[model samples]
Each structure stands twice: as structure tokens, then as C-alpha cells.
Target: MPNATGGQPPITGQVLFYKDPQPLSAENHGGLGVRQIAEPFAFLRAAHAVPVTVTEFGVAAASYPIIFVGDERTPVAVMGVRQGQNLFVDQNGYVFEDYYIPAFVRRYPFVFAADESSDRLLLCVDRAAPMVSNQPDVPFFENGQPSKFTTDAIEFCKEFERQRRATTDFAKIVASMDLFEQKTVTFQPRDPQGREVGPVQKVADYWAISEERLNALPAEKYVELRNNGALGACYAHLVSLLNWSKVVNRAVRTPPPGQAVS
Candidate 1:
């Protein structure tokens, strides 16, 4: 998604899953069309993590560690242990055989952007996406009207925006509770002989909702969390931590450093 902070310069740096995003319009994109994504994760090959919405906690927890990023506490599904690496994606650009795919990834190339003036979201698409083409297998419009494919994309973007709003609210609650703590994950390295060598290595430093602090919350606050459906998401995040090692292990099995996985 475009930066939540309105009126910022076009999102600089890598825009996560999107390559080049532009608002969809009949005037500028009337000749465009999209093809079915045979490899759903092709765009995710370069991403180590993907933004996740609150409603995806359960399924996301099953496949990857769900954690918050930065001071905003943005929820994300961790796909790799290091920056710029995605262990789940194989050389063919497909995610692990049967892993749960986050909606954020599945909705690739199509996203919603807020029109600051109108205070409404407009559906956008990545013009550089491989699926996008003038000779597309599926047309985006027909006779100046949105085609079935475009209609479906619009509906999907709307649903994703609704989930995104709920995610923002959930993040606010987590932040307000003051439950997060900085944590460092470390692992021992192996020599060519595969023997553990040297001191432990730091994998990542990140924030997580402190379980100790959560357990110590006042009864009223705990009850409030339960009533608001955040309790399950919290535990799911905690449980997902176990998958961190799984990601590290996959990284270890990948082709040695400096070699591209894809």
C-alpha cells in the first residue's frame, strides 16, 4: 500500500511488493489487460517480508512468523531471516510447496491508494507487472466499461482496504498497551566441517509483545483485550515465534551467500 502518511513524496525506496504503481483509469489504462498469475509468488522473490492485515493472523501464523516492524508496529509475515532474502521462494519463483500465502502477496500488482482530496481510496495497479499487457489474456475493460476481471480486482482491493483499516486499529491497541519489547535473536555458526564455531551470531533485532508484561496486565485490561478479539491474535503472534528457527534453517540450506536463490 502507499504510505499511510498522506501527502508524502512518492514512496521512495522499495515499495514492498509493488514495482511501479499507478492509479487505474480508463483514460490512461484503457488498452491494458492482465494475465492469470501462474506463479503467484513471482513478485515476492525479492521481498523478505510482506505486510499482513489483522484478519490474516490465524493462517499467517501457520506458515510464517507474524511480527511487528518499526515504531508503528506494522504487522508482517516473515518469509526470510535476512534482509533482501526470501527463503520461501525457490529458483522457479514459487513459494514453498504448500505454505499459506498471505493476502498481501496474493493481491499483488493491485492495491488501494487514498485520494487525499476526496478522502477516498482509488484502486491502483503496477504497470510494470509481467501480467499487465496491452495484448492481455484478460482485458481490463470492454467497450469503455470495466470488464469482469477489472470488477473482480476492484472488489478485492475494497476488501483488502477494509481489512487494512482493522489492522491499523489493532496495531494502535497493541501500541497503547505498551507491551512491546526489543529482542535480539542469535544463532551459532558452523565451520566448513559443520562444527559449531565462534560466538553466537545476531540474526535480527526486533520488537515483540512481551509475554511477561501481558501476563502482568491488570484484570480489566486483560478482559478488554479478550472482549475485543485481540487476545487470540496476540497468542498467535507468540506461537508464530517458533517459526523463526524454521526460517533460519531454510536460509542455511539455501545456496551459500553471494549466490542468488532465484
Candidate 2:
């Protein structure tokens, strides 16, 4: 079962792009406002991977490798091969042009918090976000009621919560089938002269659905997966692995000095 507080725990200790997340309330932040998000993705500069909802598999697969992580088998869109480096985000905090931004990134600063006791979901915002303010721009509340912007944000968060629950269920199905396997992605590093040096470096090692195992599933189970819409998502994940090369190429073009490109 998903946690009543949503699928994962609350944002804490620099989870992804959020700095300080606080539950929205009439008393503590009735006068706060959020400046229009001019740089929608400036906060994602330091994130190499972002959680992705199941519905985004088709579009996310086209731009980044989709993989599962951790014991929960949470799906993620891989943006970089190295830690603390996001190939898609430039130094200026601008996401690369033409990339399909995930909903997880688009819904930044606002999230839904489910109260276990009351079974109620509360809308929350990151207090430390640059867009949050008190002096103007777009107020969260107008005349003691939620402003249009706040309403829209709440709607977006609600939809994301729905999708997140679906994703969690899908992950459980996949795990139950025992289709995942540990996979290692290796890269050949080059010296200053652009000549290959050292043995091939293992860039990343993570679990993914094994194609062989998937193909070997019983006919009845296979049909069940297809009927439940997991088949398409599984295929999308397999196809997205090809994009790992693209990540490596982008990193090579702007190689960080020393220690084999950070």
C-alpha cells in the first residue's frame, strides 16, 4: 500500500531540487506569493535524475533513459551518467532546448501531502524557493480564498498525486513478476590527446527489467501485463537505454577536468 503521505516520504535534506518544503496554511503563509516561473527548470540544475510518473514513459523515453531505482523500484528519468552532474542543464540553470521536461520537474515548489490520520491531502510549497515571496507578484490567496494561481497549482499537484499512485502500483506488479536484473553500463575514457586510456570504466550499475526474462514470461502472465498497460511502459524503458550514449556524448563535449570527467 502507498503511504498516506503519498508514495514517498516528505522532501527532506535536499531531496531533488527542493530546499525547504512547508505545508501551506492560512496562518503561516496567507500573505505569501510566488513570482511567475520565468526559469521553470532553474531548480533542476543539480539533479541528475528525477522521479517520473507512469504516464510520462512515452515522452520521457524519447529523451532520457528510464530506469528503476532503490528497493521500491521507483521509476526515474536518467539525465546524466555521473553524480552531481546534469547533462541537460546548463551552467546558467537552463534546461537544454527541446527536451521533454518531466512533470516532477514542472510541478516544482508545490506538492501534495497526505495526512494519514484524516486521509486528507494537503497542498504544500517550498518556503526557500526563489519564487516564493511576501511582497507581491502572484499572491497565494486573494480575499482569504485561494488565488487562481494557487488553485491551478493545487490542481496540478492533485493530478501528479494520481499519477504517482498509479506508478507505485505498476512498480509493484513489475517487482512481483521478478523481471528485474542488475545491469552495468560501461564507458571508455580518453586521455588529453583524445586517445582511449585505461580499462573501460563502469559508469553506472542499476536494476532494469531483463528483456530475456520478460520474453520468457508465461503466456497468461504476458497477456495480463498487456491488459494492464505495463507492456508499453516496459518496452519504453528498454528503448530508452539507447539514450545513455547520448548522455555520455554530451558529457564528453563539456568534460569536467580531472578524475575522468567528474
Question: Each candidate: what lDDT?
Answer: 0.80, 0.81
Locate the minimum summed-lDDT window of 10 residues in model 1. Answer: 2-11
Pairs in clash, predicted candidate 1: none
Error of 1 at 165 (Å): 1.5
Poorly placed runs, candidate 1 (over 4 Å) = 1-14, 36-40, 191-195, 256-262
Q: How many backbone clashes does candidate 2 have?
A: 0
Model 2, 1-262: lDDT tens digits are: 1121223234434457666777676567778987765665677866788999989999999999988999999999998776766789865667888898999888878876655455667677888888888885988888766788878888888889889999999999999999989898888989889899989988788889999999999999999999999999999999999998988778777665234544
Candidate 2 has what TM-score?
Answer: 0.88
What is the TM-score of each predicted model, taking all chains together? 0.89, 0.88
Q: Where does candidate 2 have its weakest 10-residue lDDT segment?
A: 1-10
Number of colliding residue pairs in each model: 0, 0
